[model samples]
Target: MIKAADLPQTLAVFPLPGALLLPRSRLPLHIFEPRYLQMIEDALKSGTRLIGMIQPNPMRGKKDALHHIGCAGKITQFSETEDGRFLITLSGASRFRIVEEITGFSPYRKCNVIWDGFDRDLGPEEVDKGFNRHSLMLLLERYFSARGLSTDWDTLKDADDELLINSLSMLLDFKPEDKQALLEAPSLTTRRETLVTLIEFALRGGNSEEMMQ
Candidate 1:
C-alpha cells in the first residue's frame, strides 16, 4: 500500500476545465489528445502512477494560466481502446498546491506540488455534522429540473456527506470557475455550501459566465 510519505513532490498535471477529483473519490477520464495519451503512458511507467488534475485559471486575460490548487489521483484502473485512446480511472489520493510549473521535455505540464496544508485529504473520510442533506436534495431537485438533468436519486440519497458533495461537485454542469470553487473549498461543509449557492444561483437564472466577468 502507498502512503502519503511515498507521494512525489513533482507531479504530472492534467489541466482540464470543470474537472474536480476530490480526495477519496474516483474520476473517470478519456484520453484522446496526443499529449494526454503520452502522459498516461509515461505515468504508467512512473513509481506512483499518480496525476494531478487541475483546472485552467478562469481569468479573461490569463487564459493559459493553470490554477494553483488541484487534487492528485492514483491511476488505479487503466485500459486501452482499439481506437488508440485510453480509458482510465483515477482514485483520488491527496490535494496538492502548485509550488511551480516545471518546464520539461514532456508535452503535458508537470509541477512541483506541496501537500503541506492538505493533511486532511489523506486522513479518514471527512464528516460534516451540520450538513442538511434533505435540503440540498430539495434544491437539487429544482436545479436538475431547471437544467433538464437526471440522476439516480436513490444512489445520491444513500451516499455519505463527503461522497455526495464531491460527486455532485464533479458531475454537475457548472462553469469551470464554479467547479474550481468547489475544488478549493477547505472542507466538506464549505463545499456543500458552495454547491447549494451555485444551485440557487442557477435557479435564479444567474449566469456563471456573467459572474466570471
Candidate 2:
C-alpha cells in the first residue's frame, strides 16, 4: 500500500511551458499525455482532486526545470470520454511550491508541495471608475486589430476582475518570463503594474521576453 506520505501531498501537477494559473480563476485542461492521464485517475480516487499548474523556465537548459511558484486547483468539474480521455475544469484554490517530486512513480508525476502562505486575504481595491479599464479596452482593440482578430467588447466590459485578468492572461501570447512574473507577484497591484508594463512594450514593438528582464 502506498502511504499518503509515499505519494506527494498533492495528487497531480500539470506543467505548461508558458501558462500561469492564479487564484479566483479557472483553468481548463484537456488531458492527453499518458502520465498526466494517469494523474487524473489518481486524483479522482483521492480526497482532493487538486492539481498544481505551473510553467517551466524555457530559458534554462533542458535539464533545468520549472519555476518555484504555481497555483493549486480543485477539480470541480470533469468528464471522461469514451476513448478514456479527460476534459476537466479546475477552479483555482491556492498557491503552492514543490517540495520535491516522488522518485520513481510510474506512469504519473507527483510532488509534495507547500502553500505559498496565502491567507486568502483580498488585496487593496482600486476604484476603477473605468479609466484604466477603458484604456485596456482601447489598447486591446488596437492590439487585436494588427493581428486581425476580434472579440465581443460589450461582454468584456462587464467581466469582473478575476474574469478580466484570467481571460487576458490566457489569450495573450506573453513571454514565458513575464507569465512567471505575474504568477509570483504578491498582490493585484503588482500584477496590474506588470501587465501595464507589458502592454507598453507591446505598443513599442519590443519583444515581450526582453521587457520581462
Candidate 3:
C-alpha cells in the first residue's frame, strides 16, 4: 500500500468512460493515442508512475469536462510493443476528489487531487459486512443468461468478496454514471447494496437510459 505522503498531489488523467479501477484492483490499458502515449512516457521517465482514471461527461463537449471523483493507479506492469504502443497494467492505489485542474504544458491534462476523504483506500480491503453475496450471484446468473454470456463459476467462487464485487462493478456493462456511482460509494456495504440495486433494476428490464436520467 502507498503511503499518503508518497502519493502525488497532481495526477495525469486518462478520461476513458466505463473504465473503472478500484483500489488494489488492476486495470490494463492500451496506449495508442499520441497524447496518452506521451503520458505513459512521462510517467515512466518520472519516478511517479501514477495516473488518474476518470470519466469524461458524455453530455459535455469540452475535452476537460470530467467527473469530480476518480481513482489513482500506479504502473505496475509495462511493455512496449513493436508498433510504438504501450501495454501497461495499473494497480489502483487510491481514490481522489478533484480539487482543481492544473493548466499545464503537457498534452494530457493534469489535476490537483485530494485523497483525504479516501484514506481508507490505502489500507487493506475491508471484510465482508454480511453483504448479500448469494442474492448478487443469483442476479448475475440471470443477468448473464439474459445477455447470452458464459462464465467460469468455479473460478469465480474462489475470488474474495472485495475482488468479486469490484471485478463485477468494473466488468459489467453498466452505464458510465452507474460505474461512477459504484466508484464513489462511501463503503463496501454501500457499494454492495448499490450494485445489487443496479443489477435488480437491470434484471427487471429497466432501461439504463431511463435510470441514468
Better of 1 and 2 by TM-score: 1
Segments in model 2 whose C-alpha atoms lie over 4 Å from true places: 1-8, 62-64, 121-131
Model 3 stretches with alpha carbons more than 4 Å out: 59-63, 208-213
Deviation in angstroms for 174 in model 3?
0.6
Is 1 or 2 the stronger prediction by lDDT?
A: 1
The lDDT for every candidate, in the order shown, is 0.90, 0.70, 0.88
Query: What residue pairs are clashing in model 2?
Result: none
Sort by lDDT, top down from the best? 1, 3, 2
The per-residue C-alpha lDDT of model 3 at residue 83 equals 94
For residues 10-94, write the lDDT of model 2, one tens digit per residue.
Answer: 5467778776677767778898888888888877787667778887766667654766777777778899899988899887667
- Residue 63 Cα positional deviation in candidate 3, in Å, after optimal superposition: 5.6
Greater-TM-score candidate between 2 and 3: 3
Question: Which pairs clash in the backbone of model 1?
Answer: none
RMSD of each: 1.8, 4.7, 1.7
Using Cα atoms with residue i matched to residue i, what is each candidate's TM-score against the true structure?
0.94, 0.84, 0.94
Considering summed lDDT, which 10 consecutive residues are worst modelled in model 2?
A: 121-130
